[model samples]
Target: MSSSPEKFSKNAVIVNELGLHARSAAKIAEIARTAKSKIWVIRDGEKADAASIIDMLALACSKGTRVTISADYSEDIEILNRIKALIQNGFGE
Candidate 1:
């Protein structure tokens, strides 16, 4: 499906001690790939494609960083929630 400007977002903090590192970014990207709608992680007014490891890493999100996880469509809200849960869980680190 095409991405829309409209989206649902939830704020979350990076709980992993090591932060959003390569391994954790990979997990987030993997989840993003499964979503039918576009997904993104926004931090400090910067947004990154959730499916791109490089983009996620670019956020420079360290532990305790606050970010907003959003999906382009309401139907994809669950996807964002999953992402939030992953971040809250420290990407299972």
Candidate 2:
């Protein structure tokens, strides 16, 4: 029997003055695209594919919005951390 990979998640608040806009979403999608498993950005219980800029933008997360960065597989923990750091750092705005 195969065991399911462990999920990794981290919470971060949008600190950028512009919030999670197109540029920031694109940055996240860039990193997420390299994940070994799925990466998700969740806000107010809604989940968006981190690899999809449109999906992330649809969340409409403004500054100060709290979100969770999640990875489906443990192998993606680095990806999860990178996203969390990016959000926490306000996308380097």
Candidate 3:
């Protein structure tokens, strides 16, 4: 079987009111890890490993800041959708 790789993206929200705080970072981190594909977050031209919760929180995603989330993978549209939903849903905090 052949699996084609594709990318899906959306801006991560700065919804914590106090910005992307620990709780919000943790949520994004959790979702990123759950996916089979690699997720990367880039800010100010700098990139961080999305799977590490600590790294994410360190970005200090302030309130109203936008982070681009890109995913690359195959045979996992469902996972992609979930990730998208989590971002769209603002991590359900």
Q: All candidates: CA RMSD in angstroms?
A: 2.2, 2.8, 4.0
Q: Write the per-residue lDDT of candidate 2 for residues 31-50, one digit (tens) a residue.
A: 99999888889998898999
Reference-based lDDT, residue 68, model 1: 88
Report the lDDT of model 1 for residue 2. 51
Better of 2 and 3 by TM-score: 2
lDDT of prediction 2: 0.89
Worst 10 residues of 1 by lDDT: 1-10
Q: How do the residues 1-93 of candidate 3 rate in per-residue lDDT, one tens digit apiece? A: 123222455555555466666776677677778877677666665666677767777787786677776666653455556655765566676
* lDDT of each residue in 1-93, candidate 1, tens digit only: 455444488899999999988999899899999998778899988999999999989999999999988887888788888889999988887
Clashing pairs in 1: none
lDDT against the true structure, each candidate: 0.88, 0.89, 0.65
Clashing residue pairs in all predictions, respectively, total 0, 0, 0
Ranking of models by lDDT: 2, 1, 3
lDDT computed for candidate 1:
0.88
In model 3, the Cα lDDT at residue 80 comes to: 52
TM-score of each: 0.90, 0.92, 0.70
